[model samples]
Target: MSKIVKKTKHKKKGIKIFSSALVVLDSKSLVFFDHKTFFELKFPKNTVNDLEIVGLENLNEALHKFIKENKITSNNIIMVLNSNLFFEKILKDSGDIYKEISNFIELTPFEEVCSRTIQLDGETRILSTNKKLVTTIKDILEKEGLDIQLVIPYLALDKHSLNTENILEVNGKKDLDQLLKQLLPYNLLTENTVLNGKPAEKPKKEPKRQLFLQERENNPKSKRPLVLLSIFIALIFVLIGLVLFMNRKPPEEFTAPEIHQSMPLIAPIGSDQQEQTSGKTVENTTIKVVYDNNLDSAVLLTKGLSSLGFNSVILEKAGSESNTSKTYIDFSTNYPQSLRDKLIGETNKIFVDTVVQDSEVSDYDVVITL
Candidate 1:
């Protein structure tokens, strides 16, 4: 028995060195990411309702097809499942959490359930989900020689504190937003949630009609002053407009400058010298500067870049700690190398030896991190 156990341990050790993948399972899709690099892989998408036999069949078929096409062979697998399927309950007593979870599962309507328990403070949190789905994933992967290491509900992901770069690889913004809402509720949504990584304007919550009317009624005097001020402002604006119109100069009489083409233009020393002497044309480009709670440094850096003739903006300030304080710069793959070199040379003091990489930033030429 000891010899057999030794052999098993040796086999487990051998599996760790190979490239592993994380399989993220959601209601509508299954995404595969090369775990170490977070490089995403092609995977199948199937809208599933595990409770239904037909849904499960389609999901199984999709998984089978993915395995066959990819020729996946190994036992290193990490699974992140959608939280919507999980059922969480709080138990008052600090009794055996596992036992409580099993009892809750037995009473629940779900025919197939798996449970996980956590003891926090004096209370027990029990989370249960569809066991059939988990089993299906395991069986499918196992058949393809993939071994499951961990299975976690997406909401409980914060407990593990997995790499955030993995989250960045997920394909869709809608899916990313749903994942963020489930995984990290306290963290404010940022531009990173979108595929392009450009800041997306969040829809402003409209004021409740009844509340607005009630507040207006309560402050009737406030409304009159605002109304009068609006009228006064409008009159002032009209007077200013009339005065500007009167001061406006008539179209300047066209007196064309004498043609200077007849004079031979003196050539510069060399083409390169001429190009170097040409005036710099500033672009109307916006650069996104994302920082980790260090808004003062970010603000100062933004000012510095703005002074250097680059259109810069402080894109985001992450409320939480990032994995690294080392800054990063991401720009277009085709960005001019000379400008890039100059940018790094000038900002090297502030950003240090930050590595630059390629990324998609909507309406922005580059993105910076600090």
Candidate 2:
């Protein structure tokens, strides 16, 4: 038996894993899944009114605290907005589809809305939602340092289903799991499918402009030959004048008046002058302020920089792994010292604990990290 016994080993294949987190949001609640755990948060009763998402501040605070406690990184997060908040319709494949979509949006009850369209075999599916709603939610998530990969409407999951009215409504864990299963294989986030609405159409070329140029180029009696003839005649006149001048008698020289010497029109490039010019140039340069926890201070600093004639933008740093104890001013090595001092001064006015350093790898001329 020992001699006849033989064992065969089978190899175990690796399973495909999803590293991204999926978040489903509705007017009432928000559901999050990170491949291993599921969490849900319900909004206050007065969260949504007829006009806007009124509970934005509360929602922002809740999201910030939740993300911090859970230690969720800001990377590869997908947001699915519920279908109840959107206006969905399947439009016929007309020649100008976007035009039709625009008309549809105009006729919708919502005053300002964003739309996304998907073209099927013969029909186009268009989904639109209130612009303010999407913008509010986007700002909230971004403020918490979540890198949103895609903002999609729930109707996109089952576009062809007849009863797609409430198919994507997440009532409990089972519903959320089913929705995730369907969404696992869906990855169509083209320009036309983004929450910002339909992709902008390229400007049509003006045929009249082209026609005018073409006619001028093709005319048999064109002005090119006339111009060349006129130039040739002018050259002949110049040559004749030169010959006359050579044969003429020389004029008597008159005593020239003594001229006084004046200062040079442009002063020499001194070190101090170069530094001043560099400082002026840096004043107009753009400064980027990256913030993690203190958004208010970042906003104030941005405004202050703008007031000082320096164009500035505020960006929320992605992830909670930031040194929030002290603010950092990262300037390029070639950045002028005077300009750096001014930047540091402005930053310190808003953020008290500040540290200045020269960075060789910074993308901007000046980056203030808070």
List candidate 1 segments past 4 Å from native.
1-18, 35-47, 50-57, 70-74, 94-103, 120-123, 164-370
Cα deviation at 119, candidate 2, in Å, is 3.1
Write candidate 1's Cα lDDT for 202-292 as tens digits.
Answer: 3234223221001223335657898999999999999999999999999979998898687889974553453254422235445788888
| Residue-level error in angstroms, candidate 1, position 321 | 99
Give the TM-scores of the predictions, in the order they appear.
Answer: 0.34, 0.39
Pick the TM-score winner: 2
In the predicted model 2, the residue pairs found to clash are none
Tens-place lDDT digits, model 2, residues 1-370: 1111112231323523335556677666676665345566666655666436777777677777777777766455667777666677887656665556556666555544666665445556776667666667667877778877666665555453412222223344565455545443232333223222233443244323221001223334567799899999999999999999999988988889998879657767654575676664545665777787677777888888877778755476646668468888887776766667777888878778888888888668888888
RMSD for each model, in Å, please? Answer: 40.5, 41.6
